[model samples]
Target: MSGIYIHIPFCKQACHYCDFHFSTSLKKKDEMVLALAKEIELRKNEFENDVVETIYFGGGTPSILEISDIKLLIDTVYSNYKVVGNPEITIEANPDDLSPSLSFRRNLFEELKAIGVNRLSIGIQSFFEDDLQLMNRAHNADEAKRCLEFATQYFDNISIDLIYGMPNMSNEKWLQNIETALSFNVPHISSYALTVEPKTALKKLIQTGKIDEPKDEVAQEHFQVLVDKLSENGFIHYELSNFGKENYFSKNNSAYWLGKKYIGIGPSAHSFNGTSRSWNISNNSIYLKSIAENKLPSETEILSKNDRYNEYVMTGLRTIWGISLDKVEKEFGTDFLEYLLKQSEKFIADDLLYLDEKILKPTSKGKFLCDGIASDLFLLNLE
Candidate 1:
């Protein structure tokens, strides 16, 4: 099945740890919206024979847009593509944008539901004031709690994001963050370690001693806590960093992990069609100009057999669906399968990975290190 992702490249303010393509200014928002719609129409031919199953609104902050604008984009998708019956439409939101009182003017949640937007992924990085300040989030701790309380009333398929392993954050505080998020009863929770990306304000702060670097050991401890607590709460650790109740897993993200084809619209968004991948320009102005000229404005890369194998191994090991030895043999031939077995031998011996029948899956102890393991198994393209 195929899906579509629309990136809204704008945010109220830049988070210290964020490096995503977004402009804090709203000067070109109107133009950007029209350009996004035109791009959707322009690229409709790519998915002419495919049925769109999920429409995900991700990025800098989709909630900042007007309700009408959000609806217009969804409408544009419908006009150009063959959408599935009751497609899983999701919008990534920031807590500050959600109304404190649902009865407020225009009622954002109600309007979104009216336009077929069924899911809300709120970016509730932390529930503590200190953590919020450290991350330079626009919303305070109160907004994070209040938004979820109001959101749960309108949307059943709700997901909230939390950041763990912050500098000076105790294990108790990290657990409290998860507990607070659980208290809201969101069906899905996506948590990640506070990483210091190169060139991000966070990296600068750490280098200047303004903020301490996030410890990897602390992140490992928090991940364990997250998995245990969510499992106790009846949420499945379906992927490395995602926990969701049965039947509430994110269709959009799951599709990506399963190697399903999807269209990514908007600046800096990436698209994949099985063998090839493309990404739009990160520059907002350039993306708009290109689309205005009726061009796709993206670079493409055709995947080699080795490239495909490595990707499958990486994505597969990160999810509940691990790499299938049988499928690898069938698709990539016996030589690749033999190489996979040889590469995974050390991990298997260490109990980091185990074979369930012919499917190779990561063990509980190895889940956090899956990415590293996957990388080691990658076949360097010498051809």
Candidate 2:
């Protein structure tokens, strides 16, 4: 089974730390929706042999769109694609957009369920007012709690995004954030450290000394707190940055980790088959113009053997799946497997990685260092 990702490229405000492509203006919303529908039709043939098992609506805040507009896009997919009988449909929303004041009029949560959206991934980065203002998030702390209260009443397949490691975030605040999330009894939580991406406001602030840089040690402490608390509460640390109760892992992201095929539609969306990958133009205006002219503004690349293997190691080491030596030997031949084993000896001896039969996985102490270890194990193309 395959998956589909729809990007909604509009937001009400720009978060200081976000580097994702999006426009804060809504002047072209209607036109962009039309262009998205056109793009879906244009790419349907790419997935002719696969039945869509998941439909994910991610973006510049998908909660900004009207329910009718969302339905239009879903209808386009249903009409053109071979989707399963009960595909998991998820929409990423922010707290302000789902607040009682805004949702009471339309009963947004119930409407979403009626229209086939089974899951909601709310962007509740923190449950503290200071952190919200510090990140310049569009919503306040009260709205965050209110939305979760409303959402849990209607949807059980819910996930919330949280952020840690802000310059001013203390351990107390970070622990409170986790406890606040638990208070809602959410089945899934996706949390990440505050990263300063180049060209983002956070980077500029740090460069000018307007804000302090995020401390790696502090972030590591926060991560440990997250893992311990969640594990004690019966949540599985299935992935480095994700925690879920039984049967509640994110199917869409899990498919990505497993290297399944998925078609991404809209500006800045990415698509991957087993052998190649492609991405749409990041500019909304250019994307709409191209779609209007019956053209796709995108670029594709065929993966090299080395590229595929490196990606496999990178993703595998970050999750419970680990790396399978047998699969490597079978798919990439003995030379590659031998090279991997030779390179892994030092880390294995240091207790950063462990070998269980034929599978290699990161030890608890090495989980935070998985990326670095994976890079060290990469094979430089000798050709």
Candidate 3:
């Protein structure tokens, strides 16, 4: 019912489009790892709920850490928290982090498995050299392809990330990307349409005319291709960008979509309970110093009724479960819920939404524009 996310805010290199809080230098890796353990101990009982079903090691790149560091984290969690038996523990990895030869360094994967990391989310942004160059991702195309072959030998619950709608990426290339993922037999695949996030190097490049501006129309086309090809390959379009085969979906991510409470550790990580949201300072040095001083370094916000409604719309509309009219009415009053249902009517008529009993789910056609539609339905207090 509850989960924990620890952000390892360090990467070997910064990708152009990445805006996540990470230091390219590994100088603080040892100190940061220690700080994470200390923080975990400090906030051990923060989860009022006793059941912890998922633990996710996310961020800059968890795979960059030594096996001992990962083990130390797992030990800390098990010792300090009430981890459920057989909890889903995931580590985010990059292709370059994994060994190229399957037979070589076999102990690395075994050691990780022994330490209870039951899942791996590998960042294989693209399987093309040109795309890798554009993103400035550390791994080459071949490394991306080979790492999965090795991973499948040791891990079954594997999720690979891919980027679509790269400049000059045709429909044929997009299809090939999906086909490449299928060939790896990866149980879960997450594909995202590249966006020029604010303050990211990608945005700067575009502004400086070093890179072409991304086209929304091209992104939309690739997204459609992603959904269609994955569905045809027997992958369920569970979330907007996530496709999973059978029961291979990510438990941690699914919890977020379901509005479940979670505690996030480390800098720039966000935590949400049913009522309020909190986030840590994005600066690593500040976070470390604060935690070292036995201070919980985070800013807290209590959600207003309108804020809660907006969050519900944003998270719910992005998933397969969608927003529930009955739940909304119960939580946000009949008037607000009525207005939401009324707003959805036009979308439903336009084949962008579907009404199933008391539920309002987005159609496949609406998935790409989910955020925009959800924002449109947000309850803004004009008064």
Candidate 4:
């Protein structure tokens, strides 16, 4: 099974730490929506033989659009692509858009359910006012609580995103954030450390000494707190940054980790088959103009054997499905397998990684350093 990712490249306001491609202005929103629908139809044959199991709407903020606009995009996909009978449909929403009055929220929730949206990934970031201000989020702490309360009444499968390890975020504050998220009874939580992307406002502030840089040790501490608390609460640390209860794991992201084929539509979106990957233009106007001219403005790259092997190791090490030596030998031949085993000896000796039968997994101490270990295990070239 395959998946489809729809990128909505617009937001109500810019978050200080965000580096995702988006426009705060809605001047071209209508045109962009039409372009997205056209692009879906234009690329329909790419997944002709595969049935779509998940349809994910992710972006600057998908909740900004009207339900009708969302339905239009969903209908376009249905008309052009072969989808499963009960596909998992998810939309990423910000708290501000979902913090309307009770009546309005009920109507919105019903409309979404009627249109086949089975899951909601809410961006709550934090429950403290200071943390929200630090991130320059549009929603206040009260709105964050209110939206989740209203959402729980209507949706059973909900996930919330939280940010930890801010510049001044103390351990107490981080624990409070975790407890508040737990109070919401969300089945899934996707949390990440606050990284200062190069061009984001957070980086500029740090460079200018207006704000202190985030500490790696502090982030490592926060990550452990997150893992421990979530596990204590019966959540599975299925991925490095994701925790879910029972069957609530994100099917869309899991498919990606497994290296399944998916078609990404809209500006700044990415698509991957087994051997190649492609990304669309990031500019909104340029994407619209190109679609109007019946052209796909994108770039594609063919993956070499080393590139594929390195990617497999990186994604595998981060998830519960650790790297498989037998699969490596089967897919990349015995030479690749031998190289992987040889390079893994040091880490294995150091207790950072362990072997269970033919599968290799990261130890508890190695979880935070999985990416670095995966990099060390990479074959730079076939030579």
Assess every candidate by TM-score: 0.98, 0.98, 0.97, 0.99
Error of 3 at 351 (Å): 1.7
The alpha-carbon lDDT assigned to residue 174 of candidate 3 equals 84
The list of candidate 4 runs beyond 4 A from truth reads none
Which stretches of candidate 1 lie above 4 Å from their native place?
A: 100-102
Ranking by TM-score: 4, 1, 2, 3
Give the Å shift of residue 172 in candidate 2. 2.2
Candidate 3 per-residue C-alpha lDDT over 1-383 given as tens digits, one digit per residue, 9 for 90 to 100: 89999999999998999989999999999999999999989988787456789999999999999999998988998898888989999999998888656655477788889889999999999888988989999999999888887889899999999998787788999888888888988889998889889999999999999888878899999999888888888999888889999998889999998889899999999998889999999999999999889998999999899998888898889888889999998988988888898888888898988888888888888999888889889889921
Q: How accurate locally is residue 31 in candidate 1, as Cα lDDT from 0 to 100?
A: 96
How high is the CA lDDT of each candidate model? 0.92, 0.92, 0.89, 0.94
Superposed by TM-score, candidate 2 places the C-alpha of residue 337 at a distance from the truth, in angstroms, of: 0.9
List CA RMSD, all candidates.
Answer: 1.1, 1.2, 1.3, 0.8
The TM-score that candidate 4 achieves is 0.99
Q: Per-residue CA lDDT of candidate 2, range 1-383, in tens?
A: 89999999999999999999999999999999999999999999999999999999999899899999899989999999999999999999999999957547248888898899999999999999988998999999999999998899999999999998888788888999999999999999999999999999989989999889999999999998899899999999988899999999999999999999999999999999999999999999999999999999999999988888899999889889999999888877788898899989999999999998899999988998899999988887822
Better of 1 and 4 by lDDT: 4
Q: Which portions of model 2 show Cα errors greater than 4 Å?
A: 100-106
Across 118-198, the per-residue lDDT of candidate 4 in tens digits comes to: 999999999999889989999999999999999999999999999988987888889999999999899999999999999
Candidate 2 weakest ten by summed lDDT: 100-109
Judge candidate 2 against the unseen true structure and give its global Cα lDDT, from 0 to 1.
0.92
